[model samples]
Target: MTAPASLRDHAYQTLKRRIVEVQLRPGARLVERDLAAELDVSRIPLREALRMLAAEGLVLLVPAKGALVATFSPADVRDLFDIREVLESLAARLAAERATPDTLAPLTHRMAEARTATVSGDLRRIAAANAAFHAEIIAMAANPLLSNVMGPLAARTEWLFRLTASRDPVEQCSEHEELYGHIASGAADEAATSAFAHIAAGRELSITLAEKWSDPDFDPELIARGRRRRRVES
Candidate 1:
């Protein structure tokens, strides 16, 4: 018989899904007692899950303030995309040099799904398919270290995409198709160039949307004060 998942694993998956889907918005406080009760898990496992999330850059643990969803600034967005562009571009180049027909097949299928999602105007599906397509490229590269580094960044990218909701799905799918062609043909330089352009475009869109949606009066000090008061009350 298969072993049951541990409580910590379950909590981590559930909380990560919620965070990625924006059920837990940026900067939302995660009270351990409430979350433990909600998930029907004890505090010990929940705390372990929170630590894992924090390590992945999805959660922030203040000294006495418990956990909160990680917040993004324009600088943060820029930094993330900058690193993503470099790493993903390298991944594309490596995939172009290494990928076989079998490795490329999954990306081709995902591109079709992304195209359909684009036409249907399903943002969530578009996002998922897009992420899957890129993930396939990373897998094709066959570097464990690269995969490990890109994993959390990919999750953060998903969160940014959901928050912005600004990508043109049709354009994105077209770009992916182009990128796939380059990789399939073993055009390493072209594949790297295409990947960099794709991520650079996304970075701009994310930054623009972030600026539009950001609160004008958002004060970190005020939030810290509120957290302190809550801690005192509890």
Candidate 2:
């Protein structure tokens, strides 16, 4: 029989989801007491969860200050995308060479979901579908080493996307379709090249958006209020 999840695991997943989804924005203070009460978990498990997230680069724990959400600078964003471009290109190339119809089916389904999500005009769904599509590609690559490295990078990438929130659905869908075509056709070189180009473009866009939106002295309270307001409006 499968083992049940522990409280630490549960807290970790909950906090990680909130961070990735931007409910807990970058650089927001993580008060242990508040979080413990909010999550209805004991301090021990919550601290363990924060430690796990910190190891994954999702949370920051300072010497004097307590835990906070990880913040990405423009340079950090560029560096991450640069690494992603290299790794993801390799994944696409390997996927093209190795993927069978069974492996490719999930990607095909995710592409359709992305298209539908694009038309629905829900940014959250669009983001989720886009992530699912790329994750499927990585899974098809069949490399545990690559997946392990890409896992944390992918989480950071999703956080960046949530911050920018400016993707053009039609354009993104078009690019995804093109990439999918190369992978499905088993064109290894083409798949790698396409993946590189797609990520490079995203890197540029993310950098630009980060520069435009970033505030050096960002106020976490204001960010929290804005998020609350957006939630109510939606």
Candidate 3:
């Protein structure tokens, strides 16, 4: 028999993935009764899962009302990128400083995977590959504290990556290649500079869309879908 903790964890991962993938769009109401029925879990475990998501800033719980999917704004995007710039740059520097063929293998593979996905021209695949590349870089840093700090922000980071999928994948992939060259060559300073520059370029685009999304008339559904279509067309 499954323990209560197991059920709760299962519900948490499912809900977290749905939210990150934007299947549960920003600002969507999460009715406990409906969610419990849909997930085929008891209200107790479902609520536990929601509380975990809430702690991660993916859900908002009201005192009297139920929960709602957390919404992002221009300020939020700015804040997120600001944190990322600092953290990711440090990771890149550490990765470069500690560079060895063995440590760099996964990043190399991730870059190759990203290039393949870019050539395939599937937006979702491209986004996933891009995220994996960054994750591999973080892992290469060999800093458990840094990884723990970044772990919670993964969902939000992926959501932003999806929103900005319209950006030129070729150019982004090229940037990653350059960063990889720096790390591979053990150029710590160059690696850090490259990482900061890459994130700074993406930051502007994210902030722009977030600003546009602030308009009440803007359709939230288009956040991922429309941008993705535009990329494919281009």
What tens-digit string does per-residue lDDT give for candidate 1 at 1-234?
Answer: 222349889988889878876777677777777787778888888888888898888887876646777777677888998898999999999999987888888777877887887888877767777877888888888889999999878777777766766667778888998999999999999999999999888877788777765555655444533633222111
Residue lDDT tens for model 3, 48-146:
998899888888776556676778778889999999999999999999999998999999999999999999998878888998999889999999999
Q: Report model 3's TM-score to 2 decimal places.
A: 0.86
lDDT of 1 at 82: 82
lDDT of 2 by residue, 1-234 (tens): 222248788888988888888887677778777787777788888888888898888988765546778777677788988797898999999999987899898889998998998899888778778888888889899999999988877677767767766867778889999999999999999999999998888777788877765567765444433322222000
Clashing pairs in 2: none
Give TM-scores for every candidate, taking all chains together and pairing residue i with residue i.
Answer: 0.87, 0.87, 0.86
Which residue runs of candidate 1 sit more than 4 Å off their true CA positions?
1-5, 213-234
| CA lDDT scores, all candidates in order | 0.79, 0.80, 0.83
How far residue 170's Cα lies from its native spot in candidate 2, in Å, is: 1.3
Q: Could you tell which candidate, 1 or 2, scores higher by lDDT?
A: 2
lDDT of 2 at 23: 84
Error of 2 at 102 (Å): 1.3
Best-fitting candidate, scored by lDDT: 3
| Model 2 misplacement above 4 A | 1-5, 217-234
Candidate 2 versus the native: TM-score? 0.87
